[model samples]
Structure formats: C-alpha cells, structure tokens
Target: MNLKVIAFDADDTLFINEPYFEEAEKKFCVLLEDYLSHQGLSRELFTTQVNNLPLYGYGIKGYILSMIEAAIKVSNGTISVDFIKKITEYGKDLIEKPIELIDGVEETLQALHGKYKLVVATKGDLKDQQRKLHKSGLGNYFHHIEVMDDKQEINYQKLVKRLDIQPSEFMMIGNSLKSDVLPVLEIGGYAIHIPFHTTWEHERIDHKVEHQNFSAVEKIIDVLKILQ
Candidate 1:
C-alpha cells in the first residue's frame, strides 16, 4: 500500500475508554434501581443518549445530561436535586479518569511516527479528546489531530481534502468498525481494525466487514506486520 498518512481513532483505539463509561453507567443504573430494573434503566439511558446525539453531540457532558434526563423520566420528575448533583459528579469523574494507554500503543506509534504523517482522526468533544491525548503522552507522535463531530463517509472525504492527500493514500486505524473502518474504507482509504475488549453498544456493527483495503487485527502492534 502506498499510504502517506496514518490516522488513529482516539478513544479505545489508543487507550482505555469504554470500560470506564460502562462502570459509570452501572452506577447510574444503581442510582435509579428503585424506579426500574437495571436492564430497563440501561435501555432508557441508551435511548436518551442516542436521541440527544444530534443536539448535544458526543462526550461526558452530554452523557451527564442524558443520565439526568433518564433519571427524571424514570422518576416521573420527582428525582431529587442531590441525585442530579451525583449524576453530574459521575461525568466529572469520567472526564478526569486517568488515561491508560493500550498495550503496544507507544511502540506502534514510535515505529511509524517518522515514516508517515500520523494524525488522530477521532469523534468526540475536541477539548476532551485533546485532554486525553495530552494525558496519554502520545501527542508528539501525531502531525495533526482531527476531532470530528462524527465519523462518516463525508467526514473522511473532508479529512482527506484537508490533508491534501488522495483517498487511496490515507489509512485509518481504530477499534470501532462503524466509525473507524467502514467510513474510511467507503471513501477509498485503507483501514485497520484493532478491536478492543469492550465496545460501546452504539458503535457495534451487526455485519462483518469485507473490503480489499480493510484488515482486522488482534492488536495494535500487529499493524506493523502489514505496514512493514
């Protein structure tokens, strides 16, 4: 492959992310357990979050609001102010969660840093993603960071144009097939999927992906085998 740019998805691709959100979600479920079953509460929270995506976009702040919205709906508007405060605290805790680098992330980045123009193409609140990259100590490896509002075919097209590279010369690496692989591949770019142990429910894809420019690997370090 004649790739000139290598882009990586930030969240679970570079470091630990989904598990922390899951943990916070469990707390949310418990806090509202009196009103509904854990499964029911999870369902409600998930629904609310998806509905709010267009309005609030994605991040801890939006999630915090979703939890509060879910809690109010479940409690029939009788939820106390203290519970709302606690829910807000959950989001703050998530924002401040320590950055845990994925195994072999640094090694993989080091191997390709100078060989190609590496950039971070991730979807989330710009500030949160920047903070995570800063905390991860992986900032210096990237030539640019694209904090997109969403990962879609058009988004990839825009990114390619901005980088001044042909679609065929760009490659994306990430944990989510829906956000990271499919969209990139759809735009005629190469993609490598390095699946994380846990994924967000919304990011899960029901169908297997098959593409000439796409490959799935067990770990981030394994990408070296293909790129080299």
Candidate 2:
C-alpha cells in the first residue's frame, strides 16, 4: 500500500450535513407545498418533482430552483414573485451555514495529512462545496479538492491520471460504497469504505462482496493502521 494520493468524500463522510439539510429541507418543502396548494397544485406532484431533480444535478439551490420552476409551470404563472425571492434567500442561507465536521475528522485528517497527498473528492454545488471547505478549516490539509457533478468511472479515472498516480498507489477513503468504493476498485485503485452510522439516503451505496480492492471499517480513525 504505497499510497501517494488519498482522496476523501465530503458531506457525511467528514461532517454532519444531513442534519443541516434535514432542517432546511423541511422548511423548504413546507413553503413549496404551501405555495403550490394556494395555486391549486398537488403537493404530491410537487414533492415527486423536487425529489427527482437530483437527476438534473446535486445542488440544493438547483433543487429549490427546479422546484420553483415546477411550481411556476404547475401554477400557470400563479407563483408570486415574492415567494421566489423568499425561497432564493432561504436557499442561500442553507448553502452558507457553517458546517459541522464529523467526530474525529480533524484528528484523523491531521494524522494522514503529511503522510499522503490528501484530496477531497466530493459531489455538490461548486459554490456551496467551496464555501463549506473554506469554513471547515480542513481546507489547508488538502492539495486538491474536487467537487464533481457526478461520481463515475470516467471522473474517478481522470482524477487518478491527472494526479499522476498509478491505481495501486492511490487510495480513496470514503463513506460511500457506490461512489467511492466501487469506482475506485474498478480502476484498480485501493478503496477503504468507512461506513457512517447514519448514511444519508442520497449517499447510500450498495456493496458487493466480490470486489478485491474494497474493504470496510467501523471508524475513520482506524485508517491509520492501513496506511502504516
């Protein structure tokens, strides 16, 4: 395990973003549903559209905007301009709030910082992702931070090639089996899946027992032993 570059996932892997989103999303959905109801739109229809917008992209701002667009279409332009303003403002607040790093994140990161080329390979809105990284104070520990539009084989392969690292010499430590473990293993890179107790629904990854380069841990702090 001659790891030259080690990338990590952001969001739940490093911090407790689910709770923040939970709080904001509840308010967001209620407001949207209320506006939709006032305009004779079905709440169920609106909710389905809102939830499915992730197929377009992963940003909450985009998701909100998509919801508003759907609402406007469903309302036949009945959605008030004032409501749009309010939701946009609230979305910005959701994007800019201070992120809370997960337990042992700092110590674990500090432990591996000097020993590996630390990178953040995460998925989300670029602006929001950068803001969270800037605020987390863990930004300095990473040489590169990739806030990708999607995590797929091509993106993961490009990252490895761009970093000039061979597959075996690179490691991806993250909480997602679908995004982090599978793709990295497909390219022959080593991946360590450190499962979080509360996996966000969006980040939930199905695991396969057949992957040779994939493994799991109960906690991230144990990653040091593998690297050592």
Which candidate tops lDDT?
1
Model 1 Cα shift for residue 123 (angstroms): 1.0
User: What are the per-residue Cα lDDT tens digits for candidate 2 across 127-224?
Assistant: 88888888888899999989887778888988989898888888888888888888888888899988776655556646564676777877888887
What's the lDDT for candidate 2? 0.76
TM-score of each: 0.99, 0.83
> Which lDDT value does model 1 have at 216?
93
- Regions of candidate 2 where Cα sits further than 4 Å from its true position: 34-56, 73-77, 197-200, 206-210
Could you tell me the lDDT of residue 31 within candidate 1?
91
Candidate 1 has an lDDT of: 0.95
Q: 1-228, model 1: which lDDT tens digit per residue? A: 899999999999999999999999999999999999999999999999999999988888889999999999999999999999999999999999999999999999999989999999998888999999999999999999999989999999999999999999999999999999998888899999999999889999999999999999999999999998
Query: Which residue pairs collide in model 2, if any?
Result: none
